[model samples]
Target: MIQHSLDALARFSAPDDDQLKALHNSIISLSTEGCGPRECRALLNVFERFPDHDGDGLFSSIVHLLEPCTGYETMLIKSVGPASVPFNALMSDRLLNSGVTEVGGQSLMALLAAAKAHH
Candidate 1:
């Protein structure tokens, strides 16, 4: 299921408005279908790496969809890995200030603290 979505995304070199909308719909569908932690991580990686052809609004939308997924905080931090400092900074800022759900926010904070301790 995840691979199908990823493949659909990969096929678009330069998606038009309709294509983008379709992608958005697909993402919404994926959320409804339920994504596992590994699948969510893969999706996050792809979304984070997506070229900012639309000022990153698409990426942000995609991230929002996965925000409620299980193990999202752990997958989000793991998705950061050791690259893309700018993306990491953006995520950090979002995590710090965004109006995420209370449980989500607490989970992210706990993961961040654990990561900090390990590093």
Candidate 2:
């Protein structure tokens, strides 16, 4: 299902809102049904390439959905950028509360890099 949506996404040079929404729905559905590594990677790939046309809301929603899945913190951290204010806030909150670990460290560094890039 996700692969089909992803293929559809790839076909478009500039996807319309409906296309984006379709991909979004597919990701959400797959995540809820237990997103595995392959599914996570595909979803992350979508995030990596696709622009969040509906403000940052779409990206934020996907991030929130995927955050608890485990084994993908590094990828998720790397996916965030300064443009998504909601993601920055979420990462900041996570950093403040999360103990010093590899994932936390990566999130902090990604946030710093994004801040630097933004400025």
Candidate 3:
């Protein structure tokens, strides 16, 4: 499932506009069946491709798609609650070093802030 999502994302990011539309449509189909954390991670990977990827209303749209399907807030609470220091540290490490920073740090920070706000 995640592989499918990644393929779609790659197509969406390709130079061909028609391929982008097809990939977007495929993503829509996947989202309709209800996505999960894996799908969210895949989408996040795609969103990290550009410094401005999180801008232009794309990040919000991704979060909106993920929030409902993933039950993200509840999962966050359930996964580690508020007191899991190790979990937070690991998450912070992953988020900070996530590939997005190779292009620009600020956008990644903004994305992190947005994700936290969503939570």
What TM-score would each prediction reach against the true structure?
0.57, 0.59, 0.46
Q: Flag clash pairs in model 3.
A: none
Candidate 3 displacement at residue 22 in angstroms: 2.8
Residue 23 of model 3: what lDDT?
Answer: 53
Q: Give the per-residue lDDT digits (tens) of candidate 2, residues 8-105.
A: 43553344677656756766676657666666666566554554443235666666656676666666555565543444435545754676334645
Single out the weakest 10-residue window by summed lDDT for candidate 1. Answer: 80-89
Model 3: per-residue Cα lDDT over 1-119, one tens digit each:
55666667655664355755655665676667677766655555544444243433444455556545544433332232223323322343344565434112234344444455544
Best by TM-score: 2
Candidate 2 similarity to native, TM-score? 0.59
* Candidate 3 or 2, higher TM-score: 2
Can you write out model 1's per-residue Cα lDDT over 1-119, one digit (the tens) per residue?
Answer: 66777666655445577767767766766877777765576556654555344423666666677766777765566554334334443565576687542343345555445545554
Question: Which 10 consecutive residues of model 3 have the lowest summed lDDT?
Answer: 80-89
Cα-based lDDT for every prediction:
0.59, 0.57, 0.48
Backbone clash total for model 3 is: 0
Q: TM-score for model 1? A: 0.57
Over 4 Å off in model 2, which ranges? Answer: 2-15, 51-56, 77-97, 104-107, 114-119
